[model samples]
Every structure is written in structure tokens, then in C-alpha cells.
Target: MAGGFRRSGQQRQPKLQGKGTLEKMEREGPFKEWLGMPDLYRHTLVIDGDTYTYQVEDAELPFAPGDKVVFRYKEVKSGKWIDRNSLGTWIDPSTYNQ
Candidate 1:
């Protein structure tokens, strides 16, 4: 799509990943404890002084509480933690301001 829109397949559609780069968030790393609620999808991440609300899949990773971090989404006017990756997992935003 030229409009930067992705045609999300059916919700039940399976994701065929061969486990090279994008592995399941649960087995990714230390932040695995922040896995999102699969059925509820409501997750919250407070960084700096702002609260970000976003939905995540069952096995996906949600934001974590930290001191200083970099969030790629500056336009969260929609009151939702915008998904920059669309993989149900946002980037690792634990890096402090440098």
C-alpha cells in the first residue's frame, strides 16, 4: 500500500516465522516479564512523565517502568501508545537520554 497502510490479515491468521530475528517475546530477553494480557489487550507504560496506553497480543512485550527512555512516538494524541513496529511489540525503550 502506497499510503503506508498495512492490510492486517485475519486475526486468527498464523504468523510464519523461522526464528532468526523475530522470536517470541517471551523468550526474547530480561523484559519477558512484561508480557501483555492476551485476552484483555490493555497495557500501560509510564515513561518520563507521560502515560502511554496500548494494546498487545498475548505473548507480546509491553512497556516497562524506567527512569529515562526514548519513545519513538511523539504523536500519541490518539491517547494510545502507537505501534511503530506493528508486531504487537514496541521497541526496547530503556535507553536513557544521551
Candidate 2:
């Protein structure tokens, strides 16, 4: 592997959900070293005064600015969280059980 670490299908942590108004969304790059590599999409969303950023292969988001949304995420660090869904995972409005 590139960094002396074997790559595996590892889930970092259990997914948690949050709700907030969509303050912003920005997408950047299809950055890759080679032509055959997949495009990388960086998604940044500002929600409830906090910034949430992540990158993935897809460019789909469930909410837009000014929209109140319930979404899923997983904490990657002490206070850093990433959307559980590549884009923004949508939660049913009727369910806020978690």
C-alpha cells in the first residue's frame, strides 16, 4: 500500500445523525493522478454554525441553503464529523428518534 497501511473496507465509527439549516455547499476537484482514476468530489456544508466537509465519488446532496435537513454523519475525530452518506444522507422528517 502507499502509506505502509493495507486498505480495507473499514467503517470509521458508528453513524450519527444531525439536523440543521443548510448554510452552504461547495464542490471542488476531480483531482486524480491518472486518467483512469475515478473523479473525486469534495463536498462542504455549513450546518448549525458548524462546518462539515467530506469527499466522495458522487455529487449529490439532499438539501440546499436555507433548507432545514436531517442528515447522517460519523465522527472521524474528537469533534470532526463527515456525512455518513457520500453526499448528504436524508432522514425521514417524521423520524428523529436518534
Candidate 3:
């Protein structure tokens, strides 16, 4: 998963705790790359009935589909696994530009 703000259930409080004024700014930070190459293997997080695939290429980084993985382009750029339900949305190259 991208290294940024992640949504949690009501049981867990927000990570970026502060007044409303600064909360917005705090939410925005480094634009995490989610579509390079797989690095470290992170556990799978199924969200909204979608089975998202995650894996590690090197051994210490984490990455997901559409999201740039940790490794640079010099290595394997893409890998694949079966999406049984195809629940998650697939992002095209054009969307990444925005």
C-alpha cells in the first residue's frame, strides 16, 4: 500500500490528529509512488469487497497494483496474479498522469 493516509474503521482514531485548520494540510504529504515495481511483501488488505493483490520483489519494500512498487524500472516492471472477482478498479496509464 502507498505510504500515506490510510482509512481505518471507527474503532481506530485518525492518525493525523490536530485541529481542523491543520488537518487538511497534514493529510497531504509526499505523493507515494504506487506503480513502479513490487518490493517488500505486505499483507493483503481486502477493502470494499475487493481483493487487492500485494507482494514484494526485493524483500523490504511494499507495493500494490497501479501504485508504483518499490523497485526501479531497471528490474521487472510488472507481475500478475489472478483477480477472481475483479472487484477493484483498474487504473489506466492516463489516470496516473493526473
- Cα error, candidate 3, residue 61 (Å): 7.4
Which lDDT tens digits does candidate 2 get at residues 1-98?
45444468454445676777778888877667478888877777788888887667767655679887666677656554566454444566588785
Ranking by TM-score: 2, 1, 3
Tens digit of per-residue lDDT, candidate 3, span 1-98: 24443465224322221111111101112232476643334334332333233333323222243332211111123422223222223345688889
Pairs clashing within candidate 1: none
What is the clash count for each candidate, in the order shown?
A: 0, 0, 11
lDDT for model 2: 0.68
**Candidate 1, residue 33: lDDT:** 37
Residue-level lDDT for 58 in candidate 3: 27
Comparing candidate 2 with candidate 3, which one achieves the higher lDDT? Answer: 2
What TM-score does candidate 2 get on C-alpha atoms? 0.57
Q: What is the lDDT of residue 83 in candidate 3?
A: 30
Score every model by TM-score. 0.33, 0.57, 0.18
User: Would you list the C-alpha lDDT of every candidate in the order shown?
Assistant: 0.39, 0.68, 0.29
CA RMSD of each candidate after superposition: 13.0, 7.4, 18.2
Provide the lDDT at 27 for model 2: 84
Q: Candidate 1, residues 1-98: lDDT per residue as tens digits?
A: 54444577434323232111221122222233345723434445554345554444443454333322343333435763535444233334474453
The candidate, 1 or 2, that scores higher on lDDT is: 2
